[model samples]
Target: MNVSQPGLSRSIALLEREVGAKVLERGRQGAQLNAMGTALIFHAEALEAILERAREDTLLRSLGLEGSVKLGVTPITAAGIVPRALEILVKAAPKIHVSVTEGLDSEIAEMLRRGHVDLVVSRIGGGSGYQELAEEELFRSDWGLITRPDHPIARRASVRLSDLRDVRWVLPAGGSAFRQQMERVFASSNLGWPTQSINTNSILAIKAIVMSTDCVSLMARELVGVEVAARRLCIIALKGVENQRPVGVMWRRNETLSPVAARVLEILRRISKDELAVRKRVELPKKGGRSVV
Candidate 1:
């Protein structure tokens, strides 16, 4: 009671006001419990303990630290970016359990609508349904041409849309936002568009097709950066066409995030900020290289 006397007195006074009884005494040391006060304090202490325990339980459950979060992402996200980000999330919150599903953007969006994933990491497409979702941009990157290191475009300092004009292409399907953006860019060019284009759903398949055939593909620069750096694929700059697109996180607007989901989102946003900072630090100025405008 000594430790919690002030709180207890406040509680008793509030109770006494409703009950019309004197429940506490003011003294030199502090509040003193009368007979009625003593009895009420015992019950109040017990109730407080129960409520505290209940609150702790609810907090833990809500955070999903003791439960699991279902998340969906596009293939490019699953392959590298998300996995790297999750590694950081695990380090920060080990108790959190996450189940990840990888699919093309359309499929993943459907999954999110059906209550499959608690959150989604995807491109901000022109879809009207996603307009109301709470979203934050994670990264922005320009589209670049990806091909085998020995591909003809690889030798060029900067590849023009005309350079890829006649090449057969392996591309993500029209349903994919990235694919649509690529198509739009090409359609605006003097090259028109690739009639010989093959629509693929798999990023791996696109890379494979580009490697095995005289085909070229476009992808976000960061998505293919590791492969480009390793010399497995070449990322040729798209001179004069700076198509910087934003990758973002989205969650249902009507739904409140569970504790676990919130924690995961926090981790993702933090990682995004860190990645953006690093990108900004190393990024070339607008006059020198591509800008994600």
Candidate 2:
């Protein structure tokens, strides 16, 4: 990028010759990348990522470090699952350092494709580009109505999406894929969305508000394992509401993970089995029923 005019011209000439097309659309103002240029840059960035991982490995080896991982997660997983996994991961391989980043589906999915993050742990079916990545399903959790234990809906012996229609809602930030998915449940049932709602991306905020008020929200059950255990919140458990929104480990197809990332992936899978077992021990809510955390 810091090349002289002559050097830059030479590099562009070489690239155009190799690709058999002009990589740039030159104009009097300067130049802009063509389709070929954009595609080449994407692959070039991926190549840089592969080399960067190799470089990290080399440096770690010389310095006698166990290595580190950059792990991407969604908010739901960050709530309980990832922390639980890390508890085991740290004890299992204490030397391996894991740097965790929590983001919305749109953000993390792109990071996975660009190799900005070594691996992404999230629910399947984000949208168009998500299906291109390979998946290793870890665990499945249900989505449903969540409310405080003393709330009126919590007292109902039988409930439906109709019951949630008029209630105040604690919704995710507007326009997030997660928020869209939540809104779809109501739309699918002709219930429409709640006109009265609180929007936030924080799992803690959702839990706090749901536990103290009648504002119901939808989320994966696994996200609130702790509050469920302590009886701080309860599920409105819907029947036949379509579960599997299963969370799993995702990475670019045909990509090889670095030693550190691979180790973390192994621990995530190992811990997920215990998560799979929790489906049998809900104590609070029934499985085979719709749930939200």
Candidate 3:
């Protein structure tokens, strides 16, 4: 990818010779993909996916184990459901390998479509227009107005959406679903946006800023689970069910999961159910592999 222009042109020329057709239409401007190139590229990507899957299976057969999975996740999912689910997976099936890619939903959608990832764990918000993909609900968590315990908003007996109009916020950047959720809350209540938006998508950064400063955040309750349980953060009990949504497993429709991936999926379902129960109750579950979240 970092090669010089002449070197790249030589490589493309070689490919064109092997294909017995001019894949690139070369001009003074630069080489551009021809119609033949465009068609070839689609099947090339599909072939790459098949090769990757075959390799994972071959490695599994050599090692006498289940296999590997390419797992895609949104940032929120990495912080929330993934950790607890993987913890159980490794203990239950230590021989299986997992590779995780963390990105925004849009980026992850493309990855899933191209077969760069075998499955996706993310929140479902209308979703990208990939009818080939299907989602299975794993857990549901509500969006909350969160702040430090001693913050002015937290001390209030009751809060309103208008109260947040003047509040400073540590929010995700405009493109994120989390940010859209926050905007929806304000718009539905006929309130203006926050006076100061301290933009970031990191749950860790949001929690750190909220605890050290007077800023508030609109976040999924499950994302701040450990901190909330430790009294380091608190939800204001606004928008109980209004913005609640399912966190699910998204994979290609009609494609059977690889053996190791199916095993990991089973563990994810088990851990997510337990994780949900804890958030709804005052205390956590006493069971092992189910209480980490």
Candidate 4:
């Protein structure tokens, strides 16, 4: 990289002028890239990789895999599965660099549509608005009620929707699919919704609130598996509250994926299959049964 302070300043000014937005933030410490600058850098890097591939196609082919992959992932998939898959990918193909964007399902799908990301790993369903995107089912996840390990309700043999009607709850945003499913379950059981509720989309914040307070929340079992295994969280076994969602990979419909992206997708598929097999072999506790590690 070459350095020219005056030229760099002029270039930055021109970019800001053309985009009608400030791309950088200047402060006491130093200049830093703002959101717009960060986005520009991401696209610039992708373009650079594309140019490099064009110049060294034969070399890259000989090397097998060498490029960048931009991935959009939902919070749960990012927390539970993506890291492990990335670790395996790095060991298998060190030259295939991966960049991940973690967000809600809708946000990631929009990113995919806008070409901000190469592919997305998220819960797929009808009316998702990305029907034109190609999808490959990876696995399925079921939702369950979760709370702190030592919460008073954690010791119950069985729980009911009516029993939870008055308890404090950490809920997803209103009108979201997860929230709607929970509400349907409560309604079907003839139970009123909780009056005391904290609505958020951040899985980490929800987990923190549940762990430190008495608030209970619904979450995918695999997403909270590590905490449950460590006895930090407990899943309430309530009958007739089954809610399963399909987890999958989504990409642009008519476009071919970059080699690195394709390889990463392959790794994710393999990991998903392995995880599903493991879950099947591990006997799950029955409804009204105590927590099992």
Candidate 5:
């Protein structure tokens, strides 16, 4: 009558029929599942394990996280966050293997469109024809002016575009939103940003150049904070700039995610608070952003 007790009732029924003997002397003192009943229990235990494996395999394949997932990201990922996220995921699911690659935002986006990369982490621009790609805003950063400690303008707590009128600049490549923002700030001040520059996304390379020259670069405050604290570089707040730059997650809209990719995205959505705090100390927004995983 009680099918719920798999260990007792089921085993008793199974063993009694198999052995043609009263394996369990039920309704007696201390009577329990007998040797034959116990043997049946062990067999059922093994059978459960087999069924569980089948179920897990089916789920893993359906999610696309089992075999492999390829990702393309910008230089920042190579520096820390993505790699660290993968490290945590590997510890949790030892069998899942993930491959990560790095490239410029445009290049990564191309790879995703061509079915080359499963996911991409980069700046979203234009959004011209990415109907197949879905974007999820991950975090945002503020742009600040960075220069060597001894640079003439380094003494200022903050700087307006007018203050930087004659200062030489190192900027991102022509199409970057940051560069556009800088140009707009300069234009609003009735001045022009020096076009002679080193254009790069390599933070360390840019830092090295800034530390060695009188040139200034605009970047996330957290990116140069370490050098600032060490007096190798200094941060001058931008007085007339919009501080929000949204970083996002991108993946194919219609395609299914692999099991490993799904798990990686899970770890990535948690990336803002747990991962960013260690790398840049930036505040990750809660509540509004949608998570793919």
Candidate 6:
């Protein structure tokens, strides 16, 4: 903060030369970070956080457990699993501080590779392209189509993929895992993709759009279980389209997890087991009733 203008300029020039890119724009309005500079600052902050955590670990060793964990999670797990697990983590290890980043699988994987996050909770299959990471399945959830409770399709006894082709839909953008799964479902059903669709990566936006409009979207049951139970949304009864995906905790392979991270992981595993058991109970058929399974 006490840096002189000339010294700051020299530092910026040195960094630019090292990176071989102009990180800042100099003008009458003063120096401003360009896009590349902003990205560099973000990574630099992550590195600083890592160093701070290291310092905390070194100093807190004799005073019992006290450290920080940077965790990344996908939207569904962020909404469903992280809260419960974090609750347990806080109660068990009061001195441990946790930072959470919510993102898609690919985004979180990149963060893990860059050492930005200590661990990630994301989908485990379909060639995630993170060969340097290790993952353990936390739970499995089935994907299903969701719409407003009073939507016309929600009233039907059964819905088909073909029926969805003509409806407005909210879908994830291209190359995302959810989008790929939706494409596979369309291909398997021999139905054309929906022409009227809004593509986005925000789970909250998708849910809001689907619940307020005639649009429908696919999501993990666990993600929307609370909403469905509250009668805010309804799952379209579709046969032969059940797709189960495994969600899990992932960390860099060959690296030992920090004490706080390890403890948080343990809490997540226990919570996931309980969640799976609850899901199984909800999935079980009632007496003299047919089960979706």
Candidate 3, residues 67-131, lDDT tens digits: the string is 78889998678887888888878887887778999887778877887788888998875657788
TM-score for candidate 5: 0.62
Q: Write candidate 4's Cα lDDT for 94-122 as tens digits.
A: 87756799877788887786666888988
Q: For model 2, what is the C-alpha lDDT against the true structure?
A: 0.76
Candidate with better TM-score, 1 vs 5? 1
lDDT of 2 by residue, 116-180 (tens): 78888888755445555887888877785677877777755447777566789898888676777
Find the candidate with the highest TM-score and give its number. Answer: 2
List, in order, the clash count of every candidate structure: 3, 6, 0, 0, 7, 0
Kindly report which residue stretches of model 1 are placed more than 4 angstroms away from their true locations once superposed. 1-65, 130-132, 242-244, 283-293
Clashes of 5: 7
lDDT (10s digit) by residue, model 1, range 80-178 = 567877887788778867789977677877666555677898776446465446677887767778878777666665678876667888988767666
Put down candidate 5 lDDT per residue, 1-293, tens digits, no spaces: 55576676677667678779776656657777677667666557646644654566577668775566678987545554577778888788776746688776778886776666778876664454867789877666666788887788776667777676677777766775545656776676677667667787566778899999999987775466557657687776677776544666788787777667787787878987664566466433222121001
* Model 6, residue 15: C-alpha shift (Å): 19
Higher-TM-score candidate among 2 and 4?
A: 2
Can you give the TM-score per candidate against the true fold? 0.68, 0.86, 0.78, 0.72, 0.62, 0.74
Ranking by TM-score: 2, 3, 6, 4, 1, 5
Could you tell which candidate, 1 or 3, scores higher by TM-score? Answer: 3
Better of 3 and 4 by TM-score: 3
**Relative to the unseen true structure, what is the C-alpha lDDT of residue 270 in candidate 3, on a scale of 0 to 100?**
86
183-291 per-residue lDDT for model 6 (tens digits) = 8887788877778899987778899899899999887877787787777877655677756578889998977898788988888889888877887688643221212
